[model samples]
Target chain A: MIRLGRKHLFEDLPRFFASLGGIVFAVQLVVVQLGIFFGFVHSSSLLIQESRADFWAAAKEMQYLEITLPVPYSWIAKARAVTGVAEVQPIIIRSIVFENSNGALDYGRVVGFDPAGSLVHLDDHPVGDLREIAKPGAFAADAGQLSSLGVSGIGAEGTIRTKKAHLVALVHDTQPIISPTFLYTSLRNAVLWSPAMIDEFVRDPFTSSFDINSPLNFVLVKAKPGVDLVALRGALERALPNSRVLTKAEMIDVTQRFWVKRTNVGFILGLCAALGILVGMVVVAQILYTSVNEHIREYGTLKALGIPDRLLYASIIWQAVVMGLIGFIPGLLLGLAVAGYAQNARGIAIEITLPITLEVLGLSIAMCVVAAVFAVRRAMTIDPMIVFKA
Target chain B: MNEPRAVIGDSIVMTYPSAAGPVHVLRGANIHADRGEIVLVDGPSGSGKTTLLSILGGILTPASGRVTIEGTDVTRMPRRERACLRLARLGFVFQGFNLLRALTARENIELPLQALGIRRAERLKMIDALLERLGLADKGARRPAQLSGGEQQRVAIARALAGGPVVVLADEPTASLDRENGAEVMKLLCELARERETSVLIASHDQRIAPFADRIVSLVDGRC
Candidate 1:
């Protein structure tokens, strides 16, 4: 009733600040970890999420967008014949080695799609013309990848697997976490000049093993209006028995799962966030417990004087809530600053949206209140009789 | 008519089980105080002076005894009900002047009144009057650490009397003070208890202030 909780907490300035520091550390850790988790999940599935296709038909073993085995290009005919399917386009994504004019070599993934197909869409964060990559030996890369891909700007000359290549257009926000960089080009150039396929062609020159017309990573399918995409996907899966037919949402889900569930990065970051909560709880509980111990005599006096146990416990809980609210602000601000740094300097995504901010604030307070439980238990056990002892 | 009995502890027995078996701290001790009377409990160390006071205040339940304050049997009542009765009709003073260190003198005095569910305006009015009457009006803004021993004890007295309780319990209220301060605290306490018609029960071994008591009960070997 007298704000005894806050008064008690602020009575010792050093310990109060120490308690605040713990909450701040916890809030920042949770915010940053969750932010990065959301960011990475978004980045990992950027290709599938941004594509303008109703469904994707990939090799049966494909688990994510980045790691697709080649499906037969001939399967394009079978997919287009499925009912409710309007169009089908074949695409290739393969790792390539690039050599710049200065002979600087770097590795990248090449995404080769036909311009006539409506599968690859970058309308949200608009980029340069897709038609530019249709030219022979021309490719498109995000501007952020210039240094990593060993290329300059547009019109920069480079070699892809010992063949001449040019940087024709620039895109934005299409960076992939699973691959170093994505170089968009025509299917003919990617199939002909991808290093892995070129090695096979050189090793078996007389065989048809390296035929360019047979290798395509995925077949993008478009559905007619009023078509239930789920039924169409089932039809495609049945017709193309060696392929996996997935709706656009399913593609995003698989990609996110591959990184979040199957990869160690997600687990370690998640563990760090949980540890932050634990550290916060420990710090706050220790501080509250110590404060109670120090003020045990006063508490006993109050109890002996007939103070209600409810009011006594409420004071401790109030201290925790105050600490949480006061400590969370700076931590959230610090998290936002770090997110900005990650996004700008390193091209890493760390999104701190409104929902994330609210969620973190709630978590901050919840952890502090939970921490107060320990102190409250200790306070409840104090014997009022002790105050009567001289 | 004789002054109404304000507090009574009937055959109170308190025991503790140790490695040596039951240690009887208070063995069937009986005590009572009338309204507006100042009663002193004097005994040697470990002779159950504090134990008698604790049972009278309902702080420690005797092994087999009845404690009554203001005509209510505190030992038989539920804990919460007993606590409510204690808040409304009884008060306690400890040896160390155990005021909450974080609160100012006025806030410390206001705590029990607040627990009694007194409104803020009424509580403030009562606290001001208590502070003024106890000679601590000007010093109510200071914390316990900032006050002298005598001043801290005066604040504790002000806190005890703020609720206008029917009975006040003091356990060695002057044990931590010097001779002059202890004498001064006893005089102020007895005067306030008389003026408020509050029964004052003090447990102390200080013989110098025995003159202030209306009656003195001495304990020896856990008996009175």
Candidate 2:
């Protein structure tokens, strides 16, 4: 049956490809939209998803990683007392404005932590000169946002919240999805720039003081090996009444859900992906039905040859499948290429994972199958006796 | 010598729903064809010759009557069974030659064998032999549209007889051919009927091929 259908396509090459063109475009639509959707899901919670912490402690009522309020710096010690707790790294998160060379201000999130023991990465490299921030004018920020984050250049001096700051080193792959830029420096420099956090008793970066009452934004924690995170979460929740406790996985999920519900990125991309599939299905069906309609006499000839409806249906389906399979090859390659371009040009990371590959292939074939249904009806309804007429 | 009847029909009746009412196309039509015989049925337009051929070929079911091929009463069978009977025992050549325009002459001839699920190598051999026998050996790779009308009819005849059916049903088998081409097609049909003992029933408006037929049945106003 497939052989017959293929032969037919060769005889009517122009019409066959005209039909194939619609399905190919459909494949591209489904692939590109699905790729964009994956990008949105990943970038929404990148910080939480990339961290090495087993558990996270943030201010009570905090719904996301990027929008944290300060909690008592002493909450780290209180959390460490829990049975499964092994280590805690106190951190501060604050929104600050960077003064561009022109003195124009650009807003970004600033993160401060003990550089020697921080779990979050600065472009997958260890922070150089961990003690440099104690100089009162030194800090490191992602370089990808030189324009967006309002940084002048590498080794350029700048100010954050009226405090002198230096861009000692630039980082990569650390651009926060929600904020235009990110700053990572020693806890002392981050405090000087964040006056609100300073008033709330931030831990002094220079003094090795565990008793400092600074208001830290978060605590990154590691459970003892063999400890269940759920149990550890319950323990931390009980120990620190003023903070929210969550496992790293749960925090990632929470952050993603918040962004999806609170922002329109997820819903918009999701709707587009669904629309792509629906449009692809309709376009392919139209192409197939039109081809069948044009070849009614050819189908009638097959019927007169004693070919049953089942084989006829199989032939039509096989024709669609051939077109779909050919179209998907380019669609997948071009879609991934576009995703790569978008990531480079606009800083959006679109990932094509194993499940998505299988899903889109299945979707391509399924749409072709669905498209053949209209043709099947026309083929079966053809009267074989039409060939007997003049 | 009298040969055994390969096809038989008795009192066949057919009616179609029209804008006005049911129009009876075949009423009390009877036809028969013996082994090694070429039967011709000629009539004017709307004489129901084509409808009678469609019924005897087992494609169109009659309102009432029996159509028997090789002693099996196909009208009593279900649709699938009747189709199976057609696939294995009957062949048809239509007015337009009815070759699949997509396939070459050889591929068209192999179509019926393909329906029977014949092996590829075997089908090719059968196609090759038939194309040679029909004087189209060199034209096997040409599509129906690429061939002349006479060549196209020969290809259709090759396709119909490729499976060695019990009988061949043709409707206006030479209507579109030139006088020379029409005579060639008639000669081939007669030779195939006699040499293979395959019966042939033709419904046509052209009387030029009548001298080749072993029997003639006239149909007028849906009765024969």
Candidate 3:
């Protein structure tokens, strides 16, 4: 039965190729889309992920990892005084505009950290250093952004919110979410550059609202050993009425939900993947229908010869499965290779693990089975008595 | 001596339902063929010649009357049982040569054996013998497209009888062939029936087919 089924499947090489083509296209679309979706989800929370803080304290509505308002910088001292708080670090994350080489306006997230604090992304110094960044109007920039920042080298200058910011040193792999142009500077200079927050005391010009010592954007907290981070979080939340300290998992969840579940990215990618599968299914079903129509007479002959419906059914299903497997191998490999390129150049992570490979393989087989059902229905209902007619 | 009847269609009445109305194709048609006998149902087009054969082969059920093959009544049986009877005991040759185009002559002949779950070695042996008997010994590997009309008919004949069925039904088997090929196919079927003691029931309007039949029953308006 298998032998006969295979011969019949290959009877029309074009139909066979068409079936395989549809499945391959579907698999590639699903794999690449899933990869890009995951990549976007990963980069969304990269800042919080890279930070060494066990708990992060932020303003009440700082649900998003990228944008946040400031809590008073003095909160760092108060948080350190808490029983289980090992250390507290002050940092400011704000959106600042920049001027490129051609004076074209570009904007990005500018981060300000306490110069003595330890939280930079460099190799030798696991924590970080702000010695060069502490210098007046100087900040460290990721070397990869030299061209984006319109700087020739160290000591080159760029305008951060119209303030003179000299690039003192370059760092590696500092791609922050929300904006690609990231600039790192000392807390004092960051406050100097950060626009002063406005208070409702706006009606009084004598009591100006432009205060450099107003607040800090983020307070990074490290918990002491033998202390439950969850309890410390509760304590910090209680100590600060309108603020929250989020854990790593909580932050990741918040970011993932923001992009995948709560946003349109997940819906759009899901629809594309489904469309790919749907296209493959429709192609296979249409092709199988043609194949069945072409061989309707043969099927009638088989029926008249006492061939059972089960054998006829088995033959069609086997053809579909064979085509699916054949298409899957090449499509999966090709899609993975393309995804690998996106991962490196576009930062889209298509981590095709072993389990994922097996899963997609299963999906391909199931896709063919479902496609075969369409042909099977037609085959089962074929009038075997057609052979009796002239 | 009373010879065993291989197929008996007694007062068969069948009507087909259509959008316009019920089509009265067969009305009280009676037919029978003895074992080792070659019977021909001669009729004009639309004379229920094909419909009567379909009843005997269990392809269609009659509205009235019964069809029995080798003592098994197929009229009251379910569709699946009737189909099983057709598979295990009946073979057919159609006008179109209906040889699975994807399969070679040998493979086509081996189809019934495959359906019956015959062992591969036995199936091959039966296919080889049938091919040799049909005078297609050297052309067993050729598909129907590659075979001449005469050769294709012979392959179709071999496929019909390969399962050693109790009866072989052929409908306008020679209609697609030249006169010479038609005569040869009829004569071959007659000879094989005599040798195997298998009953053969054929429907045809071609005069060339009559000479090869042991008996010819004329069907007019579904009456024999």
Off by over 4 Å in 2: A12-24, A126-137, A195-214, A225-234, A242-244, A278-283, B1-5, B71-73, B76-78
Report DockQ per prediction, comma-separated: 0.68, 0.57, 0.63
TM-score per prediction, in order, is: 0.89, 0.89, 0.83
DockQ-based ranking, best first?
A: 1, 3, 2
Provide the overall lDDT of each model, using Cα atoms, as 2-decimal numbers: 0.85, 0.79, 0.79
Q: Report the number of the highest-lDDT candidate.
A: 1
What is candidate 3's lDDT per residue for A302-345, written digit by digit as tens?
A: 77777888888899888888878898898798889898786566
Q: Compared with the true structure, what per-residue lDDT tens digits does model 2 show for residues A226-338? A: 99888888888878775788888889888778877898877777777667667766776777787778778878877877876688889889887887787678778877888
Chain A TM-score of each model, in the order shown? 0.90, 0.86, 0.83
Q: Which of candidates 2 and 3 is the stronger one according to DockQ?
A: 3
Instruction: Write one digit per residue (lDDT tens) for candidate 3, span B44-160.
Output: 998999989998999888999988888789899988888789988888888888888888999888888888889999999988988887788999999889999889989989988
The alpha-carbon deviation from the true structure for residue A388 of candidate 2, after best TM-score superposition, in angstroms, is: 1.6
Instruction: Please state the CAPRI-style docking class of candidate 1.
Output: medium
lDDT (Cα, tens digit) per residue for candidate 1, span B124-160 = 9998888888788899899999999999999999888
Q: Find the number of clashing residue pairs for candidate 2.
A: 2
